[model samples]
Target: MIGTLLTFLAVGIVSIVVVWIVLSVVGSLLGLTMTIATFLLFKVAPVMFLGWAALKLWAWARNNRGFLSAKDRRWLERE
Candidate 1:
């Protein structure tokens, strides 16, 4: 019957609208997550890299020169 068909059409339209709204909300949330993740990566990467480099340098220095001596500490304390 025409009434049944109309009812189906209306239900289809409502469902489509609801699905569209849900998809858009999900899309926006995904975009926000990506942006925040990228921002954190950029902000944190340099500090992390520098820290890693410093650790490597310290290890190298420790291996090459050994630990700081008492003379070195005394010289530093003089200043």
Candidate 2:
């Protein structure tokens, strides 16, 4: 009876340790993926999107006068 109880205790401890390791590894991977995705969304996406929008607006204003001030039009052309 004593041997059986000791074996059960050992198995339980081993199972707990295995579970903890698996959880930690998976959690770290998920955290890294989330961090990279967040960086791209907040840092890179806005810069690319805003740059594209500015170019499109400049083109539209150049073709359609009176849409933007003469000074603003000159600035766009200068750039």
Candidate 3:
């Protein structure tokens, strides 16, 4: 769990940095400035979706592998 969270955090940070750099260049060329509020409003939704997708993928993997832990199995059942 800790590792998964850390991995996501690292990926999210890197993704934000890359997106910011690209957007900054494009914005400059277009004479536009992105505000922080707009940035967060747009950016956070996708990051959140990514987290949700990761959970779904993890469940899929566990199901397909047929080695899910009892806790995970119960979690899936609850879902």
Candidate 4:
């Protein structure tokens, strides 16, 4: 009876350890996925905003006459 109880206890400990390891692995994977998703968003958002701004400026230039004053044109030309 004592031997049987010891065996059961060992098995239960092993089972708990296995469950803990699996949960740890899953948690690490979820953390890594979120990190990659956030990194991609940070990297792409600025480029997207800049592209949008450029498109808007191009459209405005095409539709408007003398959008910039002469001083602004001179400043732009100097740059």
lDDT for 2 in candidate 3 is: 100
How well is each residue in 1-79 modelled by candidate 3, as lDDT tens digits? Answer: 9999999999999999999999999988665445655677799878988999999999899779879788977999997
List pairs with backbone clashes in candidate 4: none
Model 3, residue 3: distance off in Å is: 0.7
Please give each candidate's TM-score: 0.71, 0.65, 0.37, 0.60
Least accurate 10 contiguous residues by lDDT in model 1? 63-72
Q: How accurate locally, in lDDT, is each candidate? A: 0.93, 0.95, 0.87, 0.92
Per-residue accuracy of model 1 over 38-64 as CA lDDT, tens digit each: 987998888899999999998898968
Runs in model 1 with CA error above 4 Å? 68-79
List pairs with backbone clashes in candidate 2: none
Model 1, residue 23: C-alpha shift (Å): 0.9
The C-alpha stretches of model 3 lying farther than 4 A from their native spots are 32-79
**Which predicted model would earn the best TM-score?**
1
For lDDT, candidate 1 versus 4, the one ahead is 1
Per-candidate clashes, comma-separated: 0, 0, 0, 0
Better of 1 and 3 by lDDT: 1
On lDDT, the leading prediction is 2
Q: Give the TM-score of candidate 1.
A: 0.71
- Clashing residue pairs for model 3: none
